[model samples]
Target: MGERLAGTVADAREAAPAAPAVLRVIIDAKRFPALGEAPPRHVLGPLRLTLRAHEVLVVTGPSGCGKTTLLNLVAGLDDELDGRIERPGQGRLAYVFQEPRLLPWRTVAQNLALVLPAGPDRAARIAKALAEVGLAEAATTYASRLSLGMARRVALARAFVVEPDLLLLDEPFASLDRATAQRLRLLLLDLLETRRAAALFVTHDLEEAVMLGDRLVVLTASPASVATELPIALDPAARRDEAAVAARTAELRGALRDLGSLP
Candidate 1:
């Protein structure tokens, strides 16, 4: 009986489909042009990374390590760099910046509607997204009136409303208070689990990276490259455990310190 069960499990594993590759980034080099008397600033590369569907890859590095530049490259906001980014088909990409980046004059629902296509179901989509982020009643509220935490929630709602294939988060929870940030992190985890979208999240917080990433990539100092890539084995429930998260964070920090990537 035990042998039969083991064979069944192995067969199931073999039958399961592999996760599709969602994004491929190959950057041979990235440099900022010289200004007047200064030389060109070498910022990043010789970096290659892949993001797969239903995966969250968090990138952590020292300050001024060109992390944001990498995001810009992936988003196609800057195409002058040495390498190329490849994505399967024309998939929608959503981004949540450090700042809310909402239009102060527009209501929360209107802000979301801007990204969504004009359709009869747009209102429903907006409402559902707002509710998912715990902001149901704030749909009609103007972005200018929201507190910092609330505004960040709206930003998240806006991102998810589009049903993106890939999500890019750049320190989305950075400036919030501890409690608020924790709440947002939980909310984000729930959304990611439900949506199963690929994500590339960037942050300096080691704990946040440990709690949220399916895999974590550590980068070097200026002209950043991959220092190490650590696959997180923690389940979703384990991520919510403060002690577990802290231990993982410490371990990651130690590895980075050993490599001289972190101080």
Candidate 2:
């Protein structure tokens, strides 16, 4: 790869706080149930999260550990969730799920248009977003015609067009190959720097966490709680070596090995 997208940057050097909203999540012992079972079980945050405005907070955990559930609660997607989730004001939020969730019937441009304000500026903004993801040539293409990675780029465009105050991502690159994932990782960092959106990202990859996260928060095995908050110690201009991204991948993997649920 050319260079690690995030480069070696001090975690403290992340974008300056811009959003006025202070986001707090307080869940007192959450419970849910087996997927096919009648009774529910809770495995997510019972603890609280106080995300100081204008920062990226990443949740890294194994599959089935309720990373998505915790994210949903914070996004108000699961209103059935009973918990105190607070925010500054009517701040806008954008969610990028594990799947692209693009509409098959819509063209890339139209799909992107859904997230922008309904006005004359919307179309141009959508086009710009698609270009940012290097999908300008696919503007009129239908979702069904795109590859998984392309579909994901479309999703990224959609999520970013709104210029949301809070951006929530759920394993957005989980299905892509390593090279493709790394490329998008760079794009995401560039976007984060420019958009300055407060982000809550959930991923299982330790390398990804150390690479992108300002503060890496790990959840315990089922019935999750914040188990670790590993702050990255790279420079903003951090790059990779031929061996790997700064050769920190193995060290990060080792750190996560200590987490019993790490895959």
TM-score of each: 0.91, 0.85
Model 2 per-residue lDDT tens digits across residues 155-221: 8889999988889999999979989998998889888888888889888877776667777787887
Most accurate candidate by TM-score: 1
Give the runs in model 1 whose Cα sits over 4 Å from its true position: 1-16, 36-38
Kindly provide the TM-score of model 2 when superposed on the true structure, using C-alpha atoms: 0.85
| lDDT by residue for model 1 (1-263), tens | 99999999999999899788899999999999999999999899989999989899999888898988999889988988898899976588999987999999999999999999999999999999999998999989999999999999999999999999999999999889999999999999999989988999998888888888999898888899998888876898889998999998888788877877672
Q: Superposing every Cα of model 1 onto the true structure, what RMSD results? A: 3.8
TM-score of 1: 0.91
- Model 2 misplaced regions, further than 4 Å: 1-21, 33-37, 239-246, 255-263
